[model samples]
Target: MQVILCEDIDKIGVAGETKSVSEGFARNFLLPKGLAYPATPGNLKKWESEKHLREIKLVKNLESARTLAAQLESVALSVPARAGREGQLFGSITTAAVAEALLGKGFSVDRKTIDISAPIKTLGAHEVTIRLHSQVEARLKVEVVSS
Candidate 1:
């Protein structure tokens, strides 16, 4: 089955894209959830017009994300946590904490955007990646210290 995506779906495609999928999956999941529509001739034409509008909106959003990424690049966040005598933190620093720190610095970034491969356990400086867009990524410095 062919369908037009109305929003970005991980492992699938982005909005305004036409993709093929199993008929059962399309009919039972995507179409009912409003994530996509059947790729009929009328819908395809509609998607063509919507694509231009979506492109413009995405461009603006990407620009904003880039600006935020630039601000984030210069920030050094300090995360304080309880630690043991060996300097290992009692609990690991998570992406949620990183996102909160970024929020404290005036950036409205989601936790999903933070790409921490592993939980931060030691008390020291670390580099983390913040994904602003598919093509825009920024590195942030995080310093973990004893509270």
Candidate 2:
């Protein structure tokens, strides 16, 4: 039996793909679980149109991510922290603080998206990576200054 997959099945096929399977498997497992639909002429036509729309949406999303990445790369953030006579800070700069600083600059960034390999403890320039999208990443300089 031929069926169009609605969702990706491990070892079988991905979503929006047509695959051949046993009649029993198609009727019992794929149909009952709503994982696939029988590939009739009408269904094939519907899937083609839906596939085109999905491609368009993916292109738009990629463009948007690239734009955001460019904007983020040019931004330099300054974070103020209380420190002693030396350059050592009383506390480390957290991901939440970075997100807050970005929010202050009119960019609503999520703390989870900011990747800091280690806690910032010194008062100097540091590199921070922001995962804006799966295909896009932006690196920005974070300057920590004593308040």
Candidate 3:
């Protein structure tokens, strides 16, 4: 039996894959478990149409990411933190803190999207990378100062 996988199945196939399996296996395991559907003409056509639509949506999302990246480049973020005798921060400037600061500055950003190799422990100007999309990234200037 020919089947189109709806979701991944270990040792069998991944989603959007077309595979040939035993009729008994298809009827008993794959179909009953809602893991796959019969590879009919209508289903294939529908899948192709959905795939095209998804590609268009992804392109639009990528464009939006790029647009955001451009706007973020000129926006310098200042984060206020308590420090000790030295300029070193008491704790650290984290991604969440940076995201919050950006939000305060009227730029919405997700904490998880802020990529920091190391926590900002010292106070100074730091360049941070913000991942808006897998292909789109923005360089952010962050200045940490004593509150």
Listed in order, each prediction's TM-score against the native is 0.86, 0.67, 0.70
What digit string (tens of lDDT, one per residue) describes model 1 on residues 48-90? 8777788998999899889888888988899888999899999
User: Tens digit of lDDT per residue, candidate 3, span 61-128?
Assistant: 88999999999998988999999888888899999999999999899999988988778989899989
RMSD of each: 2.1, 7.1, 7.1
lDDT of 3: 0.89
- Angstrom error of the Cα, residue 57, model 1: value is 1.2
Clashes of each: 0, 0, 0
Which regions of candidate 1 deviate over 4 angstroms?
A: 23-34
**Candidate 3, run of 10 with poorest lDDT:** 6-15
After superposition, which runs of candidate 2 have C-alpha atoms over 4 Å from their true positions?
Answer: 1-49
Pick the TM-score winner.
Answer: 1
RMSD of 3: 7.1
Scored against the true structure, residue 18 in model 1 reaches a CA lDDT of 93
Q: CA lDDT of 61 in candidate 1? A: 82
Worst 10 residues of 2 by lDDT: 53-62
Residue-level lDDT for 84 in candidate 2 = 82
